[model samples]
Target chain A: MIWVNTIVQGILLGGLYALFAAGLSLVFGIMRLVNLAHGDLIVLGAYLILLLVTLLGLSPFVAVLVAAPAMFALGWALQRYMLNRVLGDDILPPLLVTFGLSIVLQNALLEGFSADSQRLPTAGLASASIELGAINVGVLPLMTLVTAVLVIVVLNQIFYRTRLGRAFRATSDDAVTASLMGIKPANIFAVATGIAMIIVTIAALYLGTRANFDPSVGPARLIYAFEAVIIGGLGSLWGTLLGGIIIGLAQTLGAAINPEWQILSGHIAFLLVLLVRPRGLFPRAVD
Target chain B: MTLINASSHRVEIATSASRLAAIAGFVIVVLLFAAPAFVSRRLLQDLFFILTMLGLAQCWNLLAGYGGLVSIGQQAFVGIGAYALFGTSILLGVNPVPAILIGGVVAALLAIPTAFFAFRLAGAYFAIGTWVIAEIVRLLVAQWKMLGGGTGTSLPNSIRREFWFTETIQDLFGVRAAASRDILAYWLALILVLSVIGGIYWLLRSRRGLALSAVRDNLQAARSVGVDALRMRWFVFISAAFGTGMIGALIYMQKARISPDAAFSVQDWTAYVIFIVVIGGIGTIEGPIIGVLVFFILQALLADFGSWYLMILGVIGIAVMLFAPRGLWGLFSDRTGIQLFPIRRRLVRPMISNDKREG
Candidate 1:
């Protein structure tokens, strides 16, 4: 029963990890930039949602509706103006540029809102849990998991079935070639970031609603997202979900065995996976 | 091959010139060692911080400059090393100094597999791959009970509880106790800074160095030229990991405590090093060193301005990329035909501009 409970909790936690990474994966899949500010952006998105919730007295779920597009626009403009300028053969420039951005965002958030962590109030939503015959699961965690699946499905559908998604993949494959074919690579990147930011907003909603968050929490979230992306593979959505689960499982199992082993165990799992298959479990062949 | 002509061309210009740089290094080291005797102790502490940043810059140079892997996740190693030192010393009953090395090795071991996992990702995948791995380690660490979980881990307040072999400095230098501690920190930082720079220089000067550059400049071409791109990259990756890990250990040793947030802060690792390298110049030997100096000075001066400093760094990086993409050191290289640490050879040619241009 303890094992079952841990697995259930792990699966739900995996959802949050998947959400955290979805934006990062999408951006990388479209444009080969690993935004160092990814985690910060998620924090920023959460902050945006927090503001919406505060101003309108709306629930966190409704607040996301208002914040997602706003965050999307912020992401779009940022990529269009800042990130696009740095994309090139030399990786140092883009990495450096993003690093600067990360510091700026972190400090900005710190200045605006002191170092004290803030939590999104969900009233009883977080505490509310339904007993499923043999076990009970928190509403927040279940929602996070469902939302993770939904985000993945929507992102996948967009990537495969939508024209913009086609453009995104094309740009990812060959930016120069995509440009020659009359698709503006920069615009595609902006749109991809916009979409990714929307996902970030969703991730942020869950991040804030489910747990305590401060300005400094972005990097930790970024790390989890990064692990999720790595475990799944570079460019696959379903793979991200699985990756999140793997990490979630590793942590929970590690915790079950010995609390200290939790973090070490996930890293060990990551290393073991690398030792066996370095390209990740489901790397996109074309990529 | 005109070996005679080339040797003669390099003869007057190379060895005698390098002597000056070597002398400068000696003088700098001497002045640095003596810094605690004259300067305010607080200033000495700041200088020590500069040294660690310098070491970080050098590691960045080795990774992005020599190895061709531009990593944004180096902080993960830095944080891990910090925590590893703390963990080993606090948890496992290891001595602090040895634990620093132990921390570094732990970071190195972790990096070996991480490099393999991340290496498969080219361009962004690799960058993101490293970042993700770091994040995973951090998240796991955050939840671990023994390591202070999310709140963080602290060490003994007094570093004096650790070993002390520097009694000679107390008698001769007149810089005692706290000042002497600063001196030790300064020297340790200097040693790390020099060692990392030296390591990178040595690596680049080796046959493997040529392969590293070949892989960086052009992977397919290097493969055709009999360079084992994969192995060369992996080796450099591990070397970078080891160096970064040491820096992390040193960082925690000085800072005296390690938290999940502080240990694995991506912002410091990803951006500051990147900024230092770019502002100083990426892909050059002295770039990170110069970059670190300039950046640290600016940081000490302007960190109080908070967001303004960040804006300046961002603008500087973007401006550097736009107008001076090569970096500060790169600009210097272009202006004067001088290189203190020559990684690439530029054979002297006759001043027959017209003939060369026509050809």
Candidate 2:
């Protein structure tokens, strides 16, 4: 029964991991850019929510509603103005630029908030749990799982069912061809990054409410997100969700054996996955 | 009448301008070696840090500049080397100096598996794969209780007193044991930096160096030309690991302490090195040297500002990447064409003598 409960909890934790990884997957699927600052941007979104929660006395969820658009705008501007110039055949420019951006964001956050950990006041939501047969689950984790699914569903809809989605796919396939078809690759990229930032804002809501975060925590989160994305395979959103579950299960089971092995177990699982399937479990045929 | 022309050949590695700079560089290195004689202990220690950082930046540049492997997880080698030093000396009671070499071998061995995993991923994924591997190594090391586990351990007094040069250094400098230890560490650091820089320059001048740049410029093009890109990459990766491992060991030895976090700190070891290399010039040999000086100057000027100092560094790094991607040295070299450590081969034939004379 305990093992069953642990597995169930791990599944819920996977939902949050998926949320952390969704935007990264989205951006990579389109531009082929692996944003080193993705995790830091998520942290920045969390800080935005924190600001609204404290200064305006808004609930974390409501704070996300306000912060999402702001982040979207910032993302669009960042892509159109700065990142676009560095995107091309050479990979180092984008990678190094994002790395520098990551450092800049983390240090700026630290300078603003100090190194002290901060969390959103969850109003008892964090500890609230319900009995499901033989196991108990936290409300926050369950909500996080639902949100992750809904976000993926909506993203899939946008990717496959809309004109903007066509532009995104067309540009991703061949930007020059897309341009010939009157699709501006730059604008498409800006929109894609903006959407990714919105998802980042959603992830931030759960992250801030569920856990304490300091400026330096970005890189660790980035590792988890990267592991999840790689495990699922690049360009596959559903695979990212599964990757998150696998990591979450490994971490939980390892913790069940010994607390010290929890993080190591997740990393080992990631390595094992890489060794077995270098291209990931569900690699996109295009890239 | 028959006329014969006599030919003269010059195989000079440097131009006259760079030849002058080389002389100056040699003089500076000699002065640095004699630093213990007149410099304060604190200045010596600071120089040790700078030299170590300079070596690390060079190794990273070799991998990224010529080899095209932009790794963000070099701390893996650093941590492994540091712990290997501790393990070899404390557990096996090996001599500390030789143990540092052993640490290099251990790190290189570990890097083999790391390359196997990371090489599977292309472009950006490869970068993150290295980081994940580094974190895994750090976590695994933290669990090893023999080396003080999570808390960390300091070098034993016995081992500290037993360094071969400690006695000699103390006798020669006529200083306290602590001061003498610092002097020895400083000299070791100086040697390490010189060898790392010289070795890199020599490698760049070799034929294999041209192959490395070919591979970096275009994998398929190089492969089509029978360059064997993978072999070159493997060579660069393994050599980088070896050098980085030795650097890590020497660094921990200087501090006389080994902790997982300190040894594997992405901020201290990787990020700063990346910043230095990028802001100096990525592919050029002189870039990291120029980068480190800029780094030290910034650090000296703003280190007191705490987080703000870091923010300033972050800001400068981003600004440089966005505006001056070639870095300060790259910009300067582009305009002046003066290379202190010139590697590119140039054919210089003093205006083929137009006048023919019979001797």
Native-to-model Cα distance after best TM-score fit, residue B21 in candidate 1, in Å = 4.4
Error of 2 at A55 (Å): 0.9
lDDT of each: 0.80, 0.90
lDDT for each residue of candidate 2 in B232-312, tens digit (9 for 90 to 100): 988999899888999999899878888899998998989999999998998988899999989999999998888777777
In model 1, the clashing pairs are A223-B135, A263-B140, B79-B263
For candidate 1 chain A, which ten residues in a row score worst on lDDT? A270-279
lDDT by residue (A147-258, candidate 1, tens digit) is: 9999889988988898888888888888889999999998998988998899999999989998888888886677677777877887888998998888888888888998
TM-score of candidate 2 relative to the true fold: 0.97
* lDDT for each residue of candidate 2 in A1-287, tens digit (9 for 90 to 100): 99999999888888988999999999999999899999999999999999999999999989999999999999999999989989998888899889989988998898888899999898899999999998999999999999999999999999999999999999989999999999999999999999999999999888898999989888877888989999999999999999988988899999999999998998999999999998889999366
Query: In candidate 2, residue B86 scores what lDDT?
Result: 92
Off by over 4 Å in 2: B1-13, B356-359
Task: Give candidate 1's error at residue B173 in angstroms.
Answer: 2.7
Candidate 1 retains true contacts at a fraction of 0.48
Docking class of 1: acceptable
